[model samples]
Structures are given as C-alpha cells and as structure tokens.
Target: MRVNQAALDVIPEARPPGRARPLAALRHRNYRLYWTGQCISVIGTWMQSVAQAWLVLELTDSAFLLGLVGAAQFAPILLFSLIGGVIADRVPKQRLIILTQSLMMVLALILGILVVTKTVRYEHVVVLAFLMGSLNAVDMPARQSFIIELVGKDDLMNGIALHASLFNAARVVGPALAGLLIARFGLAVCFLINAASYVPVVVQLLRIRLREPRPATGGAVWRDIAGGLRYIR
Candidate 1:
C-alpha cells in the first residue's frame, strides 16, 4: 500500500533552520519507548565498560592489559561484523536484539557476582570480554536495522542521527557514573546496575507491535558479502 504523500509532507523535519530540537524522534510512541529504553541501556553499557576497564587495571596494573581487554571486547566486530550484517538482514531484528540483550545481561550478572564474591580473575574478565564482544557483533547490526524498521524510510536519517546522539550523550554520563560507583561501592555495583538496565530495553522490545519484513533468503554468505561490497564499490 502506498503511504500518503500529503501526510508525509505534514510531518515536520527533525531539524529546523537555526534552533536545535533534540528528541524530535520521541514524538512517535514506538520510537519514544525505544529512545528512552536505549538511553538507559546505553548508559549502563558504558558504565560496565568503565568498570571493566578499571577492574582490569586493578588486577593487572598494566596499560597493555587494559588495551588488550578493550581489543578483546571489540575483536568480534573486526572478525564477524559482515556476517552479523547478513544475520541481521535475514532475521527478525527485534528478536535478534532481545536475544543478544539477554545474553549481555547474563554476562554482566556473572561478572557482577564474581566480583562481589571476590572470585573474579583477569582470565575470567578476558573470557567474558570476548563473549560480550561476540554478542555485540550481532547486536549492533540488529539494532541498526531495527531503527529503520521503527521509523521507516522517510525518517531513517533522522533516526540514525538521533541514535548516535543518544549514544554520545550516554558515553558522557555512563563513565562518570561508573567511576563514582566504582570508587565508592566497587565494580560489582556497576556490573549489577548494568545488568538491571537491560530489563527496560528488553521490555520495550517485547512491547513494540510492528512486524518487520524479513529479507529474502537463499543466498550464500560470501556471495551476499560480495554483493554488498560490489554495490558499495
């Protein structure tokens, strides 16, 4: 069915000439729920990042190990990001996100419990960092695809920019909060709080009523990757 062009015309552009209006996407109910939940979740994710880095430093007392920890956390993206894009295209993005988010929660909870019990070691941190990074490899694409589904084509650019803004805003707040909690209470608190933050996003994912259309199936992975590359080239 064709969407109404008149209605499209009526929808305001997210950015006006001089004055800035942040949170314009929050005007839509689904996007609003998604925005708020993601805001909280991103902050928690950043908090965990800061806590994890500090925890690694505490254990190893080496900048190299800290860098290693960071690399392990993102290594999966370098290895599997293209595959993740394929999976995101083939699967229901929302369902993929829910699964990944749940896995992240579990990882955070495990780390939190380990720290609280004084049983966490550098090895455990390395393993968990890799696991979380693997999950993120898939989760990031699912999330990017899901935003397009939430706002549709016309507002997609606005949606992506808004999402980036939310991420940067959280980046500023999450680490500071994590540092405070780490200094006062301990790393366990940061991990536990990060685990708790996933709940709202999971709930919001479950609540979204729209059904995203599935991508066409029956392509080999390498062929699909090549096709994407060729298209871009």
Candidate 2:
C-alpha cells in the first residue's frame, strides 16, 4: 500500500498529484460497516482507558503505581505478540477478533460491576488490565491483517489510512468525554458504556459473510517464530 507516497525518501515517486481523494474507501459496504463499527468501539475503548487511569489514581495516588499499572496492561503485548501473531495466522481472523472482543467485553463488564459496587481493589484493576492486554496482543495483529479482506487490494491503502484517522480522532475526543462522564456519573458508567459499545462491532462481525479462508500451514510456535526470524535475516 502506497500510503503517503509523496513522503520524502525511498520507493517510487509520488502519485503524479491529485490522485488521492477523500473517503474513497467508504464506497465498499463491508469496509464501511467494519470501519463504522470500529470507530464506535475504539472511542469507547479510549473512554474506558481514561476512566481506568482515573480509577487507578483514585485507588493508589502514586505516579509510580500508575505507571506500573500501565506497564502491566501492555506487558502481555510486549511478551506475547509474536506468538499471538502465529496464532492469528492459524485461525480465521474474524473468528479470532470475535472471540477476543467478547472476552474484552466481559472483562469490561466485570470491572464496571466491581467499581459500581465499591468492591474494586487495586489488585483487581491490575489483574483485569493484564487480561485485557493479553487479548489485545492477539487481536491487534489479526485486526490489521483483516483490513485487506474488507477493502481488497485496490482500496487497501485508503482503507488503512482511514482506519488510522478514525483511531486518532477517537483518541483525542474519547478522553475528553471520559473526563466529563467520570466527573458526573463516575468510572463504572464509563466502563459499562464501553461494554455496550462493543455491541455494534459484534453485530457487524456476525453480519459479515466470509468465504472459507485458506488453512494455515505451520507446526509448533517455536518453529514459526524461528521461520519468521530467518525470513528477516
């Protein structure tokens, strides 16, 4: 995909100018539905992230502890993403995302209930963070790979760009909304709302009719990891 082909350095010259247009990728119904659902879900995800941070501060009140919590959330991604990528290659991407998203929704609901009932402990927050991060490790790679299936090679570049734009827009706006909601209704409401936001994405996932994917050919996680490294070398 020639994203920002005009950028300085490397590869082919810029598109002879005026080739790019706005929202060209939205023409595909599947991409549109997927993108819209993802937008809603991503915004809610950001909201929960902000609310979770606030909850951590309230519970611990230490910047170091807060940093530790953040690290705990991403540690799984750092440690498991390579193996997760191998797992993604062996499963249907849509099915993988559906299962991971379901897990995430359940985790969010649990946290919300804990917070609302005044039973949330710091340990609970850390443990849930770790669990959610574990899901994200697998979900992230598959989600990226699945984009081409939605828009195909023709619109692949545009689809990828639009996805990034949606994510950044949500990141900017979601935190502000989270702050307001937390100020008024509190963290539990934010988590609960995020859980609800997953509904649209799940609905879209089920609506998608995927042809049978090619079976993944590989044996053993370590062998796959070694093959990946050898390819890089």
Candidate 3:
C-alpha cells in the first residue's frame, strides 16, 4: 500500500494527550546531557556528604561533632538561599553553576589531599564543610533556574519532577556506595571521587547550547529584594 507524505507528517504531530509518555523534557538533546551530568555529580555530592560525616565520627568519635559538621555544611542554606535566588535572577545561571561547581571541585580536592596526606584535622573539616555549604548556597538556585533555559516553560514541571527523582535516587545509592568505599578504602577516596565527578558536569555545561537569558532591569537591588519579600508576604 502507498502512503501520502503529507498525511504521514501530520499524523506524527497529533500525539494524543493524557497518554503515558516518556518525559518530554528529556527529548531535548541539551537537556538530556545536562540531566545526565547533573545526576552523576549529585550522586558524588551525596557520597562526599556521607564520607565527610563518617570522617568526623572517625576523628572525634563524637556524635556532637558530626551534628556540628552537618549543621556547618547546611547552615548557609537558611542564611543565604533567598539572596542566592536574587543572584540567580541577576546572572547567567549556567555560567554561575559552572563557577560554583568548579569551586566545589577544588574544595573536594583540598579535603581529599589533606586526608590522604594524614594532615587533615577536625578544624580543617569544619572549615571546608562551611566553604562547601557556602558554595552550595549559591549553586542551588543557579542550577534550579538553569533548567528553564534548557527545556523552556512547556516541560519545566516534568523536568523538575524528574530532577527530584534523580536527586532522591542518588541520595540512596551515593550513601550506600560511600559506606562501602569508606570501609574498603578511606574517606579521602570518596572526596577524590566527588572531585572527579564534577569534571563531567563542567564539561557538559560548557557543551550545552543555551542563549543566556538577559537579566531583568528597571529596579535597584534593594527594590527588587523588597519586591520579592512583599510578594512572599
């Protein structure tokens, strides 16, 4: 049987709604690359988290110190996350993410080297944990906002849900793997692995073809901040 070319072209475009389909956002080539790279990097981030917590326990043998370390690593989120969203609105999110990810890589390497050299102290861990947390405070907003540029408004919700799924999945696998690595090797290896994981994400960010959206204007920084505050209120 012969088919009409025009009919064939029309049929593929008329996809049925409410049908179970592969997440449409993943269809974008750039987004697929970005998502894969992020997944790998997030898993490494979780692994490093587990390793760091374990290292604190090993060094101080105190649960209080471990709690302190975790708090130090997360406190900035409470303090700076709103400011971070403002920065993300003002900057190129992709470039900002690349910068923050690179910083994280360097911090991971520093911790890894200190541990491997047997020169790492509890204070060093605390300082590095705070540094990492500060970087994350900035990174999270930029990374979250970058997704809109990749897939646009049409797929934003699907992308976010998929991204959350990947994050939680990593949360599970990363800590389990870290536990194994810490038992067989050492905490330093986990940090080193985390550093290596960032490499692919950086490379992927560089390769992604995105037209960085222009920053909003017509308002002072304080005005914009106040506007956001009022909106939330």
Candidate 4:
C-alpha cells in the first residue's frame, strides 16, 4: 500500500511557516504558561516600582531619600544573590518561587493598604522596599534556572532570550502605565493592581508540572558556592 501524496504534504504544512524563531520557546506548554504569567506579573512589578519611587518622592520631598529607596530596594540583590543561588541549588525552584512571589504579593498588599488608609510613612516604604529586595534576591536565581525545566535544553537559549525580551518590554510599558495610573487614580491603585497580578502567576505555577528531576542537594553551603565558582571559572 502507498501513502497518498496529499496526506504526506499535510505533515509539513501542519505548522505555520511564518512562526517567528524568537517565539520558539513558547511552543512548550509549560513555558507558554510560565511566560504568560510572567508577562502579567513583571508588568505589575514594574508598575509598583514606578509608583514606589513616586510615592517616596511625594512623602520625603528629598532627592537623597528617593535615591535611598532605590538603594534599599536593590541592595539585597547585591549583597545576597550569591547566597540566593546556593539556596536555589539546594531546594526545588518551583516551591521557592511560589514562596517568594506570595510574600511579595503580601508586601504589595500591605503597602497598598497603608497608602489607602492615609497611614503610609516614608519609613514603611523603606522597610517594605528592603523586604521586597530580599525576596527578589532568592526569586531571581530560581526563576533564571527554572527556564530549563520549562522548555528543556534544546530551547534553553531561546527561553532565556524570550525572558529578557519580556523584562525589557515590561520596563517600557509598566512605567508608562504607572505614570498614567498615578496621575489619574493615585499610587495605591498601582500597588493593589500589582498585588492582584501575582494571583495569576501563583495559579499558573501551581498548574505547571515539570518532568525534570530535582537538583541533588549538596554538603556545606560554602562548599557549594566554591564549587559553583570553580565551575564558572
């Protein structure tokens, strides 16, 4: 028996030829879900970031203090990201991300509530900024590593490139939207919206089922760090 020529040609045409290579990572179902959630979550994150800066300036009226808020928000990443990487290696990335993201959502809600009730203080903002930064220090490394689990090794580079594109795109849109939201509704709404955005991420993360094996746990924390550094070198 011979196969029909028309039936054979359908296989090649099954996928649209115009599909862009950059979006190849999105072919994986887990990556599609993860990327969609990140799209919403990162935009919300950037919106909160812009709103936070504006709120600090409004509360303190000091350029020095505004700079301080920026420093507080990122200082943890500078100080503890190596520790975060070690932690990410030692535990499951999915659970770590869910924990960090949930905590961040709570922090955003707390800040929103403070602002809405007219009880917000510059001190509150500073402390919350530091806490959010601490969470990100852990969340970032796990997130970066988890792309491999989502898309696997074949599309790993594509997955990373797509993730960077999402971050950059969010950087542009989120701040502009924040400015508009602040001008019209006020800063509290930005924080509240950001908190709401995390809902989809947590829900999607819960839905993701990874086939990859969990990373093996190692001995001393310092030893793991040194081994990682040696491998990098």
Using all chains and alpha carbons, the TM-scores for the candidates as numbered come to 0.88, 0.89, 0.90, 0.89
Q: Cα RMSD to native, each candidate? A: 4.0, 7.1, 5.6, 6.2
Q: Which candidate achieves the best TM-score against the true structure?
A: 3
Per-residue CA lDDT of model 2 for 76-161, tens digit only, reads 99888888889889999989999999889999999999999999999999999999999999999889888877766666888899
lDDT of 4 by residue, 47-131 (tens): 9999998899889999999999989989999888888999998888888899999999999999999999999999999999999
What is the per-residue lDDT of model 1 for residues 1-233, given as tens digits with 9 covering 90 to 100?
Answer: 98754244225556666764455555556676787789889999999999998899999999999999889989998788888898898888878899999999999999999999999999999999999999999999889878766776656777889999989999999999998988899889999999999999999888776644556698898998888779869
The clash number for model 1 is 0
Better of 1 and 4 by lDDT: 4
Candidates' lDDT values, in order? 0.85, 0.85, 0.84, 0.88
Give me the candidate number with maximum lDDT: 4
TM-score of 4: 0.89
Point out the worst 10-residue segment of candidate 2 by lDDT. Answer: 5-14
lDDT of 3: 0.84
- Model 1 lDDT, residue 27, Cα: 53
Model 4 has how many clashing residue pairs?
Answer: 0
Instruction: Sort the predicted structures by lDDT, highest score first.
Output: 4, 2, 1, 3
Which parts of model 4 are misplaced by more than 4 Å? 1-20, 229-233
